[model samples]
Target: MNAEKPPGSKQALVIIGMHRSGTSATTGALRCLGVDLGNRLYKGHEGINDKGYFEHSDLADANDEALSALGSSWDDILLRQENWWKREELIPFAARIRSHIRKDFANSSIWAVKDPRVCRLLPWWLEIFDSERISPRFIFVIRSPHAVFRSLERRDGFSMEKSFLLWSLHYLEAEQWSRNFPRAFVDFDRFIEHPAQELARVEETLGISFPISVENAAPCLNQFLSRDLRHHQERESPESSPVLSLTHALHQSLLGAVDSGQPDSLEMDALWNKMESIQSGFPRALVEHIRSSGSIQGNLQITMNRLMRSWSWYTGKPVRFLERLAGRNV
Candidate 1:
């Protein structure tokens, strides 16, 4: 088989998926294995992530700002123009973004950068990082559209129409990219349901092994990991958390569809369960706030609240972005 990557900058992993698709948790899981996670890590973000975000702060912010300059935002960037890549002005501008990511992550081996925005800019990455020096192991996180639209509507107050559009665009781009590379599709729901096993599938695809100490990183998994370490792990039942079961059921539904050899339904269900499972971790109060917020505007507001918190963790600016947007330029 013809190889797309060359010998030796080490085979690095790149996580591609929409936002709220368990990218952070997966990054943490991989760190638990043996990967080098650059020079810094973002602290836990509020509203969405209770733990933290690990993507590069500036890179994310730059992408956000660029979208804003086009009079739309990330939520709506995909639908605005299919020809953003063809913009002559953006070529050199994007090249700089590529150079920066490479320089910042130069020291790491078998590194992975997980950000949904990166998927949209694949052509740019392919242009800049096409060299054989960097062997990229692509990992795509697949989640469900129903859950994604629901979550986007819930978290961002997006209109069902808007959420559906975004959900479809995001996953379609992800699916298309998956076809072009040596990639692994991770069921977000399953990864959370059986993190170790799901992660092992990714590890095997990348030809790597996770470290034995990953269990020590999260206390919630103590009982789960202690039970089996091999096949299935036992999990605690929480009285206040029936949502976990809903998430898991969604996973089984999707897995069963795949087992039945229905590729189309399997793919669709996989995306839905993954998104739903990740959101199941949110506090009950947050879920209610989303439900009551009603539609696209409400959901966007809620998601932005959480997103601000995550960006804060990534950049160590408690209210930097907020202040800057407020004209304070902090």
Candidate 2:
């Protein structure tokens, strides 16, 4: 399915979000509606999602290493790519990935890609695809800050203070890009509560139908989604939230060393100080909603729901069954 389209073709559908954000679910939803997910994919360790995800592992790993070499972690430099917009570094990498997508999905009219790292490389994408006449629609998924921070904390072992700050920064970066692009933001909370409605929204935006069913893939989806949700809301049960003793001195040490030239770092003295600044700069109502929500519990629920939806490939026994059927077909 890799045929080149004639000029003036409708753009491809690209999904953007934080790592644990509902990127996978959104991509899977598109797949359900007839988007082709390439054969090669990346998977997470067990517990996050039982079914493996379909991200391009090679691309993501290489990008992560590149980002680190620039003196920033993926979570740290997320969406902060002036270099990309200036047509300097990282553009070539984006070009390669975009080329691969075009080559791989040549015969397909619709396809979806989910790589959290894409959040930062958007400007490069626009430079390559949009300028070169490859039109593409974007789907952005968001979860509450509380959920985002909590889930991230568990995954990275980052402190809540650091987690919250990073969560805010990540969303703000994504929001800035979405505002200037053809995109839609799917609130993780809203999507899970009404999958059909969210899927329909995506369908309407991309002008395509995604008919895949979550009913059959619920087992893997549900489990993967559940853990993400549970981990994020752990604060609700302080007893379950992993507790590590920290001294005021250590807190100060972290706050003192956080000067990586991030814009929000200068605003507040405490680690959580920059959160408000980042949230203020975000260009969406969801940011406000998340700020007011206060409780991480809601966000946790949103995470689980999105995770389940994203892990469509592993959701049901049909995947194994389909493999057998394919074997017969081949």
What are the TM-scores, per candidate, against the unseen true structure?
Answer: 0.61, 0.60
Measured with C-alpha atoms, the lDDT of residue 69 in candidate 2 is: 36
Worst 10 residues of 1 by lDDT: 224-233
> Once all C-alphas are superposed, what RMSD does model 1 give against the true structure?
10.8
lDDT of 2 by residue, 1-330 (tens): 011232446456667666776566656545555567777666555667445566765455545544443334455522242453463455565666666766777776666667776666555555556554666666767655456656676677766555544544544444445443455556676666666666666556556544344454445344444323323442332422211212122223322322221223222233233434443566767544443342243344334434544656457647767877788531
Task: Please list the Cα RMSD from the true structure of every candidate, rounded to 1 decimal place.
Answer: 10.8, 14.3
Off by over 4 Å in 1: 1-9, 40-42, 66-72, 77-83, 208-330
For candidate 1, the TM-score is 0.61
